[model samples]
Target: MDDERSAVFRFLRTEIFPGGEMPGKHDVLEYSEAGGFSVEEIELLRPHYIRTVDTWAENLRANRERAIAIQSDEVYDRYLRYLTGCAQLFRKGISNVGRFALVK
Candidate 1:
């Protein structure tokens, strides 16, 4: 999961920082226009995100022993609870973990 998240962040970095590791003034303008998405986009993507997390949670549940072997029982349990809770929050519209758009 962390690797997947890192990949996403790297993708964003490419969009927001083309030349170097940090954003320049021109990059900032680009970011304002195209770097970040909007709430409507987030809302549109929420269901898909929920479905993905649901699958991940279910898979984790099914492979509990392997997960425990990879990490500690406490870590495995916490991650499972987190994924489950995130799905519920997304379903209820209480939170959107992937909502990176700045509210304006």
Candidate 2:
């Protein structure tokens, strides 16, 4: 997903850039920018998502038995692995997720 998102960003950069190092023009910016959020608010996002993902991992862990019961063991394990991979990425700061609003 991140790779695909990066490819989209690359496409946008080509369309938006005039010639130099930056975009030609813009009315808004990424969430970390002043137009989208304050520094403190941006700082809060990481820990908030960490806690959120932790809760999700806990719920998935607690429901493991039911998961396996409803599905095959392989499917259940795969789901758990997927959750763990996501948690690890966020926990390690290797990835992030956010809402991108491009307003007219």
Candidate 3:
């Protein structure tokens, strides 16, 4: 499941993000400045992006919990490895979005 999560992000980056022109152009400009957006499109995409993020977050939370719940030490350690791999993907995604939250 940990590898699965990384695969999801990889798919999002390589496949879904570049699969269309909208997200491509949206990346460079403030979303508001990107033209051809009706109020309705903006409204729809709001929930869309929110829901997508929610799904991603939930998957990460569940996988982390699943890893911690394994009883055997050996199995637990394996899950911890998976957890680290998942963390790397999350960190990469946050960086990709230019969301450096700790700026002083």
TM-scores of all models?
0.53, 0.51, 0.24
Report the number of the highest-TM-score candidate.
1
Candidate 1 per-residue lDDT over residues 71-98, each given as its tens digit: 8898787778767766775687754444
Model 1 RMSD to the real structure? 10.8
lDDT (tens digit, per residue) of candidate 2 on 1-104: 67844643454345334253422112224433655543332122555677776787689789988878898778776656555655665676655654343433
Worst 10 residues of 3 by lDDT: 95-104
> Where does model 3 exceed 4 Å of error?
1-70, 94-104
| Tens-place lDDT digits, model 3, residues 1-104 | 56776575564555445554324324534453455332323212332444455565566556655655655555555434444544454444432222211211
What is the descending lDDT order? 1, 2, 3
Pairwise lDDT winner, candidates 1 and 2? 1
Misplaced by over 4 Å in model 1 are 1-43, 97-104
Shift in Å, residue 60, candidate 3: 14
